[model samples]
Target: MKAFNIEDTAMILIDHQVGTNTWASTTPLELLQRNVIILAKFAKGTGMPTVLTSSQETNVNVQGPLMPELQEILPEEFAARIKRQGVVNAWDDENFANACRNTGKKNFVMAGVTTDVCMVAPAISALEEGFNVKVVCDACGSTNQIAEEMSWRRMERAGIGLTSTNAIVAELVKNWASTAGAIAFPLLT
Candidate 1:
């Protein structure tokens, strides 16, 4: 895909809740949290439109708010957190889909907890809908190595871009002299 243009790109963060993280094992919890915050900070610093969502909010088994680390960096007014009545695939939720639709952006940079379900489901959905999707692998977690690898393979086969936090940030920054680059460059390093 081409370079990420801030105007036409939005960050979609799904199901990165405290309850969900308890079973996440594909990536180290600490590192996953850190990478997520890194991406959140980049989006916050760049004034990118970010959409946050959770799964089965009303279900007692998996109930929690967005990860505190990410919530801290994203200002309430700037980050639009969609309340889905417990939709597993964010793309299935009207609010989440509308949020992305409202952004008027075709390119979506997304990451979420549980790579196979939370991450891959919507990534493929968005791709099928003709939206350009990029999955931040390191920032996404799964139940285990097999699930994570399988999810990556599934998304890759569908033509979605799989990348790392640093790579995505670098692609977005593009140049050090521009306004966004100047501001985001320091955050990445």
Candidate 2:
């Protein structure tokens, strides 16, 4: 497989919200949040087209609001986030799917609250749709280790690639002396 190119890749962040954060157990919430913020910063610095989605965030009792730092980091993408009513699979939500399609990107890098649900569903859907998909494992979590491992296997079986936040960042940036690397390197520290 070819390395992810900045021009052809889009970042898709799904249901990384306050309510879902409480259910994440496979990965620590702090590490998940930090990894996601790192990806968000990389996308923003590189001008990558990104899609941010939330599932019923208004119903704070259920899905609560998106991570506040996302708003502060990628303000424009956060503002344009597709707020789904109750779509379990973000790809099933027409608006979220359309936002991703509209980016004109063939490769997608994704992460979300629960690996088995929020991340897996859409990642597989996108792969079936002929898009090259990769999930940032460190940036995603699940309620348990079994669920997380199962989701990773499921995605791999379906031809979706698995990667880490740091790996993706380094792959895209290539070298610290380059412009993108210069912008992304600080976030790793």
Candidate 3:
């Protein structure tokens, strides 16, 4: 797959809710949160279309708000783009899927709370639907190490690209000589 072009890429954040994050033992919740913020800032600074979703908040048993750090980075106006889905796989929700499609971007960068379920499902679904998908592993987590590893393997075999938060930020910035780099370099480090 080609490198992410800022113009053609949309960042999709799924199930980064407090309740979902509390169950992640594969990666430190603090680190996962920080990476997520970095990605959000990258999208905001570069004007990349972004979609944020929280699953089953109203259902009894599943409940939580999006991480505060992630919410802070999003402008109040963009709140309309943040969808609350009833399904584990966000692509199953027409509102969430349409928000992404409306961006007119073919390349997608995804990061979510649960590596195996929330993250993997949408990444693969997007790929199957003809959207180029890149998973930001550092910004994602799983219930355990085994599930996380197995999910990554499955994603790789399905031809979905895996990348780090820093890589995605840097690739979008392009270079230190460019205007975006001048702003991004300080934030990335």
Candidate 4:
């Protein structure tokens, strides 16, 4: 598999709201949580810029954990890379696309709720744009197991890479003594 470097990467977290926790069916809640946490921890430990967003958290039926690892691990003043439109697919959001353009980060590590839409959409978009996309499979949640599987299949066919949280972080680090290594190694285990 192709390995990614830290300087070439960015992390995007989508719609991990309180409501998602209550209704996600594409995967078990526990697996989703574990992957999301892994992405959050990896981003913070490596200093990768990350974008966190919700789809009307206040209005949606989905509910996410407070002080999510996304919030907790990141610097208190972390800025949003982008806040996307409430559309199921994030590629529809200009701001989000701009964020990716500005970062100059070729490798995109993405996780989101409603995997078929949020995850698949941007992944396909990024691939079309010639960006290296890695979807953190366990990190994104959906409405049911079938949907989750289908989303993954779609992205895979589109040339988006599939990775687990640990592998992605390890690829970014690429060495035991790298700066991210110092912080990420402890967190990985």
Candidate 5:
């Protein structure tokens, strides 16, 4: 496979609501939290443009914490590189889609809660649209191991690169000396 073109890459984070729950996971929720935070670190560290989306979060309160961290992570010195959208798929919402189109990227990087729906939907949509998509599997969780595995198989069939959060950091860093690599290694272990 050809190397990912980082400059043309965009990160899309879906439905990491503040109180979201994953029913079955070999990786604990805390680890999922840590992995996601580190994933954001990779995005900021690499200067990758990102789109953040949450669905029906108005009724639920599972989305929070990550926003403030991004500001500190990126330092926002190069203009805000992240956009928040009020959509489920993140690709289906017009604002999200427009934000993605505005990024001029061919690659979409993403992680989300409830891999069955939240993550799977946009990933499938993007893959169908001919976007080179990478779904960060480790950064997401499902109701159970069976669901997670099934979702993984579904994504794989779509020709999506189902990767881990650590792999995503590697994709962005491509070098250990980079700030992302330095920060990512400890958290992932």
Candidate 6:
């Protein structure tokens, strides 16, 4: 409803792992990757508190490691990523949810590997917990279009705002001449 202030907003990226991403079909993989990278860069450049999580990453056959670019872009946050053991809803995992809580931010900007599963639950859960949440739509994908649309509707019904990478960048940056804008504007192109 209101603009996201950098001081009050935190980024939560869930299950953007290699294996899970391979199954994403709703959005093209290459575009998803690029959008996510842009988000990561914006978060890093803006000094936003970020929580990164993975589901069964060590079990490469399933969830594999998180996108390597995350490490390259936000190494410190990547190193502190929450590794959940097959938790479908990242919010269900105490550590992951706590990590988000610990950020002391009331607004969450989230994106994940699979829209239907990984993204929906956590977004709704956060909203239910009174957090203002906005899911980066283009930055998430699902097994199919049907699943993606269903998940989007579900989140919408639960009051979780759906947003896009470009929209978020614009919202956070606000003015190209400002400091954060100067840092984040280039990532859009």
Better of 3 and 4 by TM-score: 3
TM-score to native of every candidate shown: 0.91, 0.98, 0.92, 0.86, 0.80, 0.97
Q: What is the alpha-carbon RMSD of candidate 5 to the true structure?
A: 3.6
Question: CA lDDT, every prediction?
Answer: 0.83, 0.92, 0.83, 0.73, 0.70, 0.92
lDDT score at residue 137, model 5, on the 0-100 scale:
85
Displacement of the residue 127 alpha carbon in candidate 6, Å? 0.6
Per-residue accuracy of model 1 over 1-189 as CA lDDT, tens digit each: 667778889998888877787667878888888788888888888888888887765564675767877767876823567867767888988888888878788999999898988899899999999899999998898888999899999999999999998888888888879888877777767
Off by over 4 Å in 5: 21-26, 61-88, 178-189
Encode model 2's per-residue lDDT on 40-130: one tens digit a residue. 9999999999999998888899779999999999999999999998889999999999999999999999998899989999999999998
Report residue 178 deviation for candidate 1 (angstroms).
Answer: 3.0
Instruction: Give the per-residue lDDT digits (tens) of candidate 4, residues 11-73.
Output: 877777656654567667777777777778777777786776665555644443423555666
Clashing pairs in 2: none
Assess candidate 6 and give its TM-score to the true structure.
Answer: 0.97
- lDDT against true structure, model 6: 0.92
Q: State the local distance difference test value for candidate 2.
A: 0.92
Clashing pairs in 5: 17-62, 17-63, 18-62, 18-63, 19-62, 24-143
Model 1 reaches what TM-score against the true structure? 0.91
Between prediction 1 and prediction 6, the one with superior lDDT is 6
Candidate 1 C-alpha error for residue 26, in Å: 1.3
lDDT of 3 by residue, 32-113 (tens): 8878888888788888888888877655355577777765788552466555656778888888888888889999999988
**Candidate 2: segments with Cα more than 4 A from true spot:** none
What tens digits encode model 5's per-residue C-alpha lDDT throughout 1-189?
Answer: 345756878877776656553432645877787777787776765678877665664454454334345445545421333334445566677766777677788998888787886788888888788788888887788878888889999999888888887777777668778675686577567
